[model samples]
Target: MKVKAILIGAIGIILLFGILLTPKLKTVLKTTPSDEFIQLMYDGDVRELTQEQLKQYKDDINQELIKLKHRQSFEKIYLSLGKIASLEEGYEDSNNYLLNVISPGSHTNKMIDLKVYETLAVNYIAMGDIEKGYFYFNEANNVAYQLQDAELVASFYQLFSETLLNYTNHTNFPIYLLGEAVELTNDYYKKIQLRKQLASVYELNGFFDLALTEFIRALDMSVEKGYVDLEIKILGRLSLSYYSNQRYQDSIEVINRYFELSSDDPDLFYVSLWLHNHYYLYGYESVQEQLKSLEEATSNLSIEQKHQLSIFIDFNQVFFLHSDGQYEECERYIRKLEKLKTKTTISELTGLLIDKMKLDLDYDRGDQGIDYIKEYRKLLSDLQLTNDSVERKRLIIDNVLHHLLELGDYETVYQYTADLQKPVTQEITIINSIMNMIQNSSDSHYLAKNNITSMLLKLGSYVLSTLAGVGLTYGAYRYNSYFKMLKRKAKESTIFDPLTKTLTKEALYETLELEIELGQNELYYFLLIDVNDLSSYNESFGYLAGNKVLIEISNLLKIYFPNAYISRHYGQHFIVVIKKPNEEELLQLITSLINEISNNEKISAKRPITCCIGVSKGYLTNTLDIDEQIKLATKKLQISKQRGTGSCTL
Candidate 1:
């Protein structure tokens, strides 16, 4: 019922946005008058061109250039020549040729001159002369404004922005231009696309906060415009933005939302990626089964799409083969991928993964893996690597750590760990920090609560996915704190906690990961409840009284969320994972849970028992984004705690 309402609501939103965008969508869809033909003379389409079409265009433009040169030389001829030249990466040639149209002795066509400036800007940016590119872009904008050609200006802005992207991620200038373009054009479809570009630029620059805002706004506009295809595209890009940033959990969460909205045959390659994240987070043990299933499901993809999808498929093969003791097969696939890596424009994230696989599979040659560390780091410096590249790098470093530890090279290992890499050792350190902070219920501890919660959620994700090998490296931990954690883990090995009688933290995450891996097509609501002021209860009543409050809340949780998975997440924090078809039903349930906890006589002491609840919901996306959702809920709980006695937050 909740999912149905959401679908209906989503449909309504699309209809409303479409109605709002009718005028603007019409504008872009409508053909330009002869006056605008001058603009069309430059470039007819703003969309990505296929190789065949580009080849044909290059041929056609060259023929036109020859014809114009034979007859009478004209500004359009130079523009045509320049356009063809630029396509061949002949930036300098294109620049010199384009300058012919604007040269003192040549034609004085204002529109042609504006186009020349825009083209030159694109060329210069592609050539790495960003400052020069901006200068020409400004010139083009000025000419566009003088002509009062909003459509022309908009197209130019979009073109230059796309061009600049290849050159740099510092997108402030393009952002300014795109903002101007969006404001100038009433073309809602174009506006959404432009906003997506703007958001992407923000993301590439690591301004995820800004990127998220723009992405959400664009998503709303896409839905409002009734552009389901566009909405799907927006969601896909937004997920990539998150994935490229190493917010895999968030990436999975967005993908789940994508699943809820996307069609049956949504983008095949990203679907594969979504599956990959699903398995990585959830079904760590079911690689062969999942891989075989995905291969069958995606067999219908085009050869090109399959080529792209192979990265995920092949990587899993290497991983699964290694695990299954098919060492020769695993080594063969790894070698094949190493060759594949050279031929493909693999993203840094994928590159790191390939290298990390090498480290994992070739533990005997760990030092060789360390040698490649500089190259990966160079990728980081070049910004080709995603933010999560650091984590991937850490995994490689861990492999190196194992090799060095065997050689008894403690000094070198110490040197390597001294840097900012959050290797397995660092994860242990973080766990230590969180455990320590949990005991201290002071103001500062609560202040640290939000960060700790996020890290713990992340740690929970690593517990299965990437944590396997890291688990081995933990043998090097000589600290007593490490042993204490091991003892605690040993004692709390069951699926349910011994006290308060709910799913243990590890078990809750495991269940969430598995649910995501199963790719359940149901809306899920994650509610993170932090029992407020536990120390106060302990202080006022007694330790047993505090225990009774926790126990009673746990029981009430089962009664209230009968169909939900309830878990105790260590120290005053409890997690409730439930599926409700409609959002209203979830909200009502939250309200009831809050009231029940506050009113139950068994739970109440000097004052009614209170808890801060943070909630997040989406259809089960196979994203194993449960961790991200939990993180969000935890953040909301912290916000509630910070906001002072709030019943709940979303």
Candidate 2:
């Protein structure tokens, strides 16, 4: 699943870059629209709808525009219509409306016009008029460079590549373009797209090392952005990349981490994908046990979910039969696969899996499947080819399809640029709107005929009114933004320590209290962990180094006891509480953590940073206070510290 996610990212990068370089066919009305919002509309990020629903949506926009008294606002309505047309794949209508619209040529409009040119380029490329497409593409590129807009530049790199892939056999070219795009943008989401594309290109070309590098980069970005879905996808890809690179243990470890991250995944799709990856890594028997566990975990699924799970379960059964050398059973399961093929589009991943199953069947059949083996090997060779004509041709279409899929996934994450100004606010937006109107107006004679005093008076009043309106609007925006930030911070601070991100002491106690009240019949263990020589390390190597050690140790603890309640009180002191673990289990966990921490090469430390662990275990009840348990743990911690660094007392 993780591998698939990483590959998806790679494919996303390819698609984005493919269209970005394909042709700049997408044209929009010369109006104020953000690059992100423009991309969203172009990518059909708005909710998918039937033809009737789409017409109604367009009618709604038009009706809303009709109610507006301002003539200037009408241009915005046309732009909105153009965007909708684009979404509906009515490229000709979108182009005509965007190109024929009466628009102002102000700087803001120029930026929008750049997008229009790019849109037109894509439309043209899709229509098979590559010459016209490239012309518009160049025009858009020129405008983008002239404006010095990094975001637009980044977007172009992504979108142009996607467009190009539709019409040409450019398998590896999108990677370079996307890599440039990655360099141009600081936006986390954008970089994620670029890196994923580049990685996908590399992975498709059999450049596993390069693919892994980009996947890892994208994975880091996903983690930083707190995009759980993206993180899961990246991890799955990372694990698969590891597997492809022949790092089996690394692959297994990453798959385990995927499970840890998605323990409570609410989606059946996510669970099914994870299970698929698990089957590949752990084989049939282990996956059967996993499926049983999953069945229990997802027992309360909806009817729709049950249907999806059934499909996935059947798919897994095919693999299980094949792995078990039950050739007849596998042959029966092949019918299920054939039925599945009719239900969904045959994706590259699906094709690959099908081929593998066929190969397995052939291996079992000996000379009976010789021709099948030859054909299968040939197909695999084409897919893994570095330099082949068939591979090149396939990449052109594949890259574009991948880009479209990426856009859909991106919509799921970003939802059409939430930060874009509302249509109401955008219509009157700023001084630019007024300036564009004045500059483009045909009645310049009327303005010239007015007396200087009269014109000055009108201009002053208009400027003052616009400025006042802008100030109030900006003030409201800031206030709301700040309020949201405050709310987020307040919530975060209550549950987490500001620096370490571990649970706050209060939060830890609350968790313990809640668990105790649940009346569980089990022993709960509280452990106090103190970093040995951390202060000395801080003094010798700098505070940043000490913080690094703290963070690394905290992460290790989290990994070792993901379900446990953990907290940080003093700068380098941590409290950990877990339930009902045997002595051997506890020792192994601690020993593994200690070994990893001491040998940590990622941290730039001169010597090993060790820890003292003190533990206290007892039944949770009203008779025993949580604070008393901590005190006992702290006492044992003091003993461990006295004994030596890396010492533990229970």
Candidate 3:
């Protein structure tokens, strides 16, 4: 699952960069979109999408726009169309795209609304309208941060950060988001890529020491994992990072290793950079000789590579000519470099050199512009440049389908995304309830048949306590220790949440079963409540903090629905069955519950709390299957969770 999540993240981010980040195409994809990917894109069954289809997505947008011109209504495909328009349309014309993104009838659908808010935010940031960007980004991020899946929320942070990379003055924001992304992923390669991305952002702003740390870490992991291809490029960037920090000797040594490992195909940009940096150490003549050879080296290069290389060569020549006391030639070369910037977009970091260049050939803000990231474009290429393997191709196809469709599939979105959850078993919950009754109650006769099991559990607890007393050392666990506390809870016929003291699944089922057996007709509203990313709460705070959240939710349940039957249904879910006086009263209760959850002193003081609830109401009868009703309510919960934007009821 960890590997799969990373794969999904990599594929989704890469595809997103192609479509949403760049807006304009950079390199033409070597591999075509898989037939499966294309079909999924058009069929709208896909929840993820591949970069290969981005060109198609772009072309289709224009085609769809042409088609929409004649049509009276076109809300079904509005999300995709609006996404591209929000980007392609400049900030001055943003209102039209905003209108297109948020059609009047589209406000009810939270998922679509989320995508709209996110796109508006990203587009505004890219356009340097930071005020509007901050507004929408906070709105969208709040919605996404409240999603139930930790992976999806992490994915969104990365997506937002990566989008900010191409253009935006939000420096620390990308670093923070990428750091969040790095911690969330488990895949070695993905971590390396994310770190490189984080390092690249640092490099962009002259944070060479910080960039070096990440680069070295990525290098170590790449070598340990035998990813020679990635290691070779990291060496080139490390050389530049060293030079940026005035470690000239170290830079030369790293550059030597870069060449040694690179063998026949050295990176052209770094090759030119090396010449300028090592002018004194390698001798003016030796550097001059290498510069002559550099022109012949590009004979076999592509047009785009040649364009980017030409800029790199001119950039270095500006500095070299300046050092040689050839001020006039240096000025001419600087002018030439400025013209080269408009030719192609492949330089990545070198594209910034001209912007920061001064009349004296020095860079502004103390940032050595020429020393910024060269590995960034290559890093993304190594990670997402190709989709060669059949399995990987399918992974890209499926993941991309869902990522794009995350705007909302109203019907199947929950089924696709929610399937990633690591659910708590009802058996374990029942056992917790069972042990609670045995431990808290006076009589042991009801469960005396399970004496041996009870004895073993007691012995295990004693052993764990003894070990803790002895101060046993262990690494931090990835998940919460909630399960470890389950044995301490109470109940038999009535199952209870171990921490919250609310009912559990078994107790709710038993209650409904008894009601049906007694032949009672009742009018009740069933609400399924779920907290978003509860494990994150555990990981961020402690297990105790997470328990507090569950307890607080239970408290809110009692406050809002005092007459209702409330249960902490398994994991982060809560179930509440109540007899409502009227629709208006139920709405008020739900609104208050959501408001309290968000602003509560106990739960939201440290981290803002958010939840999604699914409400189902009907007249219950002896003939009606309660399980079916529960299933319907659960399905509604899934819907609300998927269409997340604070606590929602469907």
Candidate 4:
């Protein structure tokens, strides 16, 4: 039913776009209602409802079909029934029936035929048959454009975009299709809607800064056109983008603007809850008053709206109570949230909150809290792949690590710390060092400050005496030091990049020269990786975050191909040369590395750090200059950027 709702929303826009391409359906040969009602089915014996209930539902649809007199009307009803059967009831055969009935040459409106083809594509994608799904999807798109109906084309593109984004493995194609939809529409609001939809897709892919830019563009249009509702929505999203990039002050300012614009709107309460959660630490009393006012204003909200608001409001209260050290009160609110878990999407957050509270309560009671530790560990294992590495998750995991240290559980602590360190920022190295220190200090007693000061003074005196003796012989050392300095500078100038520690361009060329002389027949593959949106990331999250990402990428490349010749070129691009015999193996390795870089959730917390890769393979020969190979790979990298931001061009 939600899928139906979404489909209606997307296609509903088609009519507004002025696409009147509805064709009539041909008459169905006399097939009585009792001949055969569509039997709904599911895979792996997973029935959504009992067989009897499904039969009755099909009977109702068939009865309605029987009442329709016109052939076109009957076909329309059949399409609706097919949609319900396939989407809501998991009827695979109903999809096939839909395709046959609304086949391209059939006597049906272009809109109905287009919908049927799109629906089939969506179903196939959902069922894990991407090749057939893409075939039908492309079929629907081609027909829409062929009809030369702007609205139909836009509609097909929009819904098809959603299907690909939500169900399939691909994202770039859908995003490109959405851009096409936006281009096809001249309507201001429709264009804005399409842009916002595109931004949501970007946001889901962890491209927050890109999403923010889109939101800002749409916000500008909303302001110019006096579209208050759309403006408020965009402001909300823009604020979240700011928050994710750690621009808290900007986030607060945007939230304040949103509050001013949406004071009397029905969505004000929900917006207030978002503000309360994010900005509560800034002004507890003010946020509390806002919550109270929103609660008193709840009578204006619908039942469903109230449920949604209550879930967040209560969750925020749990956070507030926990912050205030009201563990008992926090538990009460946590329990309240758990009860409403089935009614909300915040169930996972609630479970995390509960686990955190239990750990704190157990610690307060002076127990080891082993059960709480085990519970949190299990939850972390289950959620690690699915959840982003946000600050809250880090704090929770770090707190657990600190608890483990307190309990002298170094074995468990070591395992979690090691696992957490891989994707975390370089700052985690400090934590690792601290853990090592703690583990070493566990069997020792603390030295008194006075005793340590005395020992430090004795060691310092001895070091100073040795240094003074050495300083007496400085004349003899100066000439040798000057020669060493020259040698060090010469080596530094020739070999590694100062910033990234990879090979310099000159060094890479020199290596290429040597390889050509010795291994001319060897297959050398050149991989060029260009970080996408890195400049935007620097603008949004500061240059430090951008530098961290670059360093991380360089480190990852080193780890993956220790023997390869790697270089950090000017800007946010890295070049790696490897002598693998198989081109397919090289491409596969490059693809996996690109995916790893793109989906690194730790870096994604500040900004979605993504990169495009271009891989070119050839033999190391005297005639083929390294610069020419780099140029070829750079050309492919540029093409990859055009095709899609985070794609690979081979």
> Candidate 4 lDDT, tens digit per residue, 1-650?
99999999988887755454443211344444322332221111213456676567567767867676666555555665666666563658768568667656568766666666777877887666766676677566545533556655666667667765555324434555576677777678878878887886666445677788888888899999999888888888777677756777777788889888887763544365465545544666666787788689776879888877777687677667666676787778777766654655654644666656656665655354256556556655644433332322544555655564444444565555344322222112322332333334433333122222223233434433432343222211112222334345447656877557788888888888987787667777888999888899999987767877887889889987888999988879899998864677767777778788877865676756788888777776774567777888998888898888778887
Question: Considering TM-score, which of the candidate structures 1 and 3 is the better prediction for this target?
Answer: 1
Assess every candidate by TM-score: 0.47, 0.44, 0.41, 0.44
Shift of residue 537 alpha carbon in model 4, Å: 49
Best by lDDT: 1
Q: What is the overall TM-score of model 1 with all chains considered together?
A: 0.47
Candidate 1 stretches with Cα past 4 Å from truth are: 1-73, 241-268, 280-283, 286-288, 296-311, 317-332, 339-650
lDDT of 2 by residue, 1-650 (tens): 99999999999999999789665444323333323334455443543456786687687776666666655555545666766686677888988766754345522366566767777877776665756766677677556645656666677767767665544333343554576688777777767867877886667545677898899989888888888888787777677667656676677678777878877763444455556566677777888899888678768989878877776776777767776777787778677777667786766556555655665566555534155424543554445432223334443324322332222222211221123223214222322333443445465554454232233235645643543464234322212233334445557778987657899998887777777678776788898988887888999987767776788788888989998888997888998888888878998888777677878885435787778899998877754567788889999998988898888899
Winner on lDDT between 2 and 4 is: 2
Instruction: Report, for every candidate in turn, its global Cα lDDT versus the true structure.
Output: 0.66, 0.64, 0.60, 0.64
- The RMSD of every model to the true structure, in order and in angstroms, is 27.2, 25.8, 32.0, 30.2
Residue 214, candidate 1: how far off, in angstroms?
2.1
Model 4 RMSD in Å is 30.2
Put the candidates in lDDT order, highest first. 1, 2, 4, 3
Report the number of the highest-TM-score candidate: 1
Off by more than 4 A, model 2: 1-57, 64-79, 99-108, 127-132, 162-169, 221-230, 266-283, 339-650
TM-score, prediction 3: 0.41
Model 1: how far residue 360 lies from native, Å: 7.4
How far does residue 586 in candidate 4 sit from its true spot (Å)?
53
Please say which candidate is ahead in TM-score: 3 or 4: 4
